[model samples]
Target: MIAATRELPAAGYAPEVDGRLKAEFTTRLRQAGGEELKRRFPMLRIRIYDAQTHAREEI
Candidate 1:
């Protein structure tokens, strides 16, 4: 399961604020979930980059 952290810039020195990695993670989990259906569904990140982009465009 994925756990939320209060720290910034994890071991990879990646940006902790932006949700790029989170989105990528969710994308991958969706694939894994497709394969493993019997067990509990894994926790995945849900970053809304598309919505943010549309919001900016509207503004």
Candidate 2:
């Protein structure tokens, strides 16, 4: 995923690459579950301000 993000500087996409990354990220997050995530990637943080309002959390 970092590789694709890095590619942003070398090229362009009309629809945007962020959406693609977001989907893959969200899927992986769902697969990881809450406890596994907290234990495996402790340093990382994710706070969704729209936990209620938004249809989906914004990571």
Candidate 3:
């Protein structure tokens, strides 16, 4: 599991926020493909956790 900690926006955890984050993660993963990501991280799961709300989202 890859846990990413982000400061909540003023508007908070909206659906769009999750979508944007997922897209950004995908882009970064692709950019870090092959040895860069696979050999180092080897993670296939992505998750977001909001400490304040105890909220979690699986991407």
Candidate 4:
């Protein structure tokens, strides 16, 4: 499992907005250059965090 944290500015303090951004980032990570890593580590797990809300999500 890989744990990561991203600090959001004031604009992303809202849960809805931050959630959307996090989702987008996660999508991009999976689509952009993550294929090779996934292929090699099929059981890989990613945990994302939002510093603003201290929200945590696993993808």
Number of the top lDDT candidate: 4
- lDDT tens digits by residue: candidate 4, 1-59: 97575445342222222233333232224334344545676676544444456664554
Which RMSD does model 1 reach against the true structure? 10.5
List of clashing residue pairs for candidate 4: none
lDDT of 1 by residue, 15-57 (tens): 1123333322212232344325323433533222222222211
Model 2, residue 4: distance off in Å is 8.7
lDDT of 2 at 21: 28
lDDT for model 4 comes to 0.43
lDDT score, residue 56, model 1? 12
* Number of the predicted model whose TM-score against the real structure is largest: 4
**TM-score for all models, in order of appearance:** 0.16, 0.27, 0.27, 0.32
Q: lDDT order of candidates, best first?
A: 4, 3, 2, 1
**Candidate 4, 32: how far from true, in Å?**
4.6
lDDT of 2 by residue, 1-59 (tens): 35544222222211112233222222224424533544676665533222223323333
| Candidate models: Cα lDDT each | 0.28, 0.32, 0.39, 0.43
Candidate 3 Cα errors over 4 Å, as ranges: 1-43
